[model samples]
Target: VKSGAGYLPVDPSYPADRVEFMLADAAPVAAISWSGRELVLPAGLPVVDIDAVDVSEFDGSVVSDADRVAPLRSSNVAYVIYTSGSTGRPKGVQVPHTTVAKLFANTESVYGFDESDVWTMFHSYAFDFSVWELWGPLLYGGTLVVVDYVTSRSPEQFLELLAAERVTVLNQTPSAFYQLAEADRLASESGRAAELSLRWVVFGGEALELRRLSDWYGRRGDFAPTLVNMYGITETTVHVSHRVLDAALVADASASVVGQAISGLQVFVLDTRLAPVPVGVAGEMYVSGVQLARGYLGQAGLTSTRFVANPFNAGEVLYRTGDVASWNSAGDLEYLGRADDQVKIRGFRIEIGEIESAVLADVSVAQTAV
Candidate 1:
């Protein structure tokens, strides 16, 4: 089971022996289990052995397909992301390298990133957003400042780091951004926010209203940090589109324009028949071209259902995003809602109707809409 450092699992079958070596070599940042007494932790990490701990403490894994390598192979295993399942089992999603690269390149092009800028990583390695904040900066030759989990969780501590680090870029959820914007220190001059050299603030992992965010930042004057709203799902690398923060645009549009498709990516609003819906008509958003995941691990049926052939073109697969959206004449997209009953609350999607149906049936809640 011996292996070199940096040996991470890239696929389901990673020579069990090699993976064992990795598991053995992995230094646990924190460990939690019902049987904490029997568990051993990696060096230099505190033990928070509870019944459960958030997935943030674990290292994120990205695996790639061996045969598919060109264009970075969206099939290439990008991450071994694990999360809680409805049946109380842990489910892992296979993200791909091509997808990650697509997102990184897209953001770089959209934001005009340069080596001089410094971006802070607030999300834990387990979260998909961390991929963008970590690798995006690295690939673009920008500085990446990793903030401690404790500091990230605290409003005061987080702002202090933002100010001290002179972070030019920040990517966080809407809730996280709201907390920072509403902080007493940032709201006042005595707070170091104004003095801090932050430039662009990116928001992802949730939908954000442009007007609300603009109004909040506008109070700080015209030079306030630019806010970028990005739309994406865990399965789709990190992001598919972005909307830059412009006060005039926000005021005029009444909503943030989720910008055009990223490079090497194609977005379409399709009706039930998988036909492209007319412009300005709401339909399921389907993602094609690069940046799409290969398929769900071992779930061929589910994978086949979601990852179907592209009727528009042969030899291509398009991901059924399940998000309802419409395109304006400018080619920008406006998100309407989820095609399914799933509800995105605070940026997380759940099926509430499914939960109620399950409750009435007195069986089990297979899923719930949030």
Candidate 2:
């Protein structure tokens, strides 16, 4: 990321057909993967196997003036993350360097990320959550511990690994964190609870279940590693708002509180006509800020439909989040649910219509409903 070269991360667990589709969508200059792994990449696309060549063979090399790399600008594309499209294809969201940078701007002051911290890269590289997990530590001069897929799936083992690695900052989806919290509870009951070094627990990728955190708080109390829940989207570049949870906040289950907007972004709960709704009234969410993505790649119509011009600010655009939310009496945005059929289960946004359409494509099936 520091080299200013845009990269498209492909999930290793994705099927060959999905991988092929992503490769076609991104149209990357070259593909890189581990040596000996047979990947179904686009035909004629150059493949760079990182393990196939020895880096020591090309030491002390410098590019000449003619071959010098161009200076990177903030507007340059940083990466492309593909999200499942309602049209039965995945659409790539082109995020610029400025957008990603805005996420970390002044975050250190608020979150206290420093060189002494040790963070874990817990999410899949293809997932937008990994954008923060992978770079947050690196940008802050902290060590990033990588968790393997197998270990990550097993909550008990993952907890043991976190303790062994002395991870200070942990980022997890609410669903995944619940599993870890359960594992910790079991360990505590068995009189074998490991002493962890975690100082911060940041939750994202899904709506946090405040009730599910009772077990964790019962064991660790309210202060040890501060728990924070953030609500975000891929098009908004990651997180827009974050709520720092405490014993009082978690116990008060009045609403799906997702906290207030972070720096560099604005969140609006608007009516169907795109006008701001009164406080305490449910409305669709519209986000406008520096962190907004450029737009969906090769999807001008979809982009236009979702990202509309901001009437308040000339030449500025706002992304229609399609999430039903409202400003509660407490002055925090409370998430109600999706405005449409988009379901967020276990951190994955799934369109029910898309699945139904896929099932209907089979010749044997006359009709189907999701």
Q: Which candidate leads the pack in TM-score?
A: 2
> Highest lDDT among the candidates is held by which one?
2
Q: Write the per-residue lDDT of candidate 2 for residues 69-158, one digit (tens) a residue.
A: 776778888999988777668789989999888899935556978998999998889999999999888888999999998999999999
Q: RMSD of model 1, in Å?
A: 8.7
* Per-residue lDDT over 1-370 for candidate 1, one digit per residue giving the tens place of the 0 to 100 score: 0111111222223334333333443432333335435333345646554656577885556433332234343345655554323332223456766566677666666778889889998876656677788886788788999897689778777877888788998888888877777673454755444456777887877667666665565675445577777888766777888766666766667544677777787888888888888888889988887777766555567678878899988999988888888888777888877776666655555555544644655556564444
Residue 2, candidate 1: Cα error in Å is 15
Each prediction's RMSD to truth: 8.7, 1.9
Clashing pairs in 2: none
Whole-model lDDT, model 1: 0.67
- Alpha-carbon RMSD, candidate 2: 1.9
- Model 2 TM-score, all chains together: 0.95
Estimate TM-scores for all models: 0.73, 0.95
Off by more than 4 A, model 1: 1-75, 83-91, 184-186, 189-193, 221-224, 254-256, 351-370
- For candidate 1, which ten residues in a row score worst on lDDT? 1-10
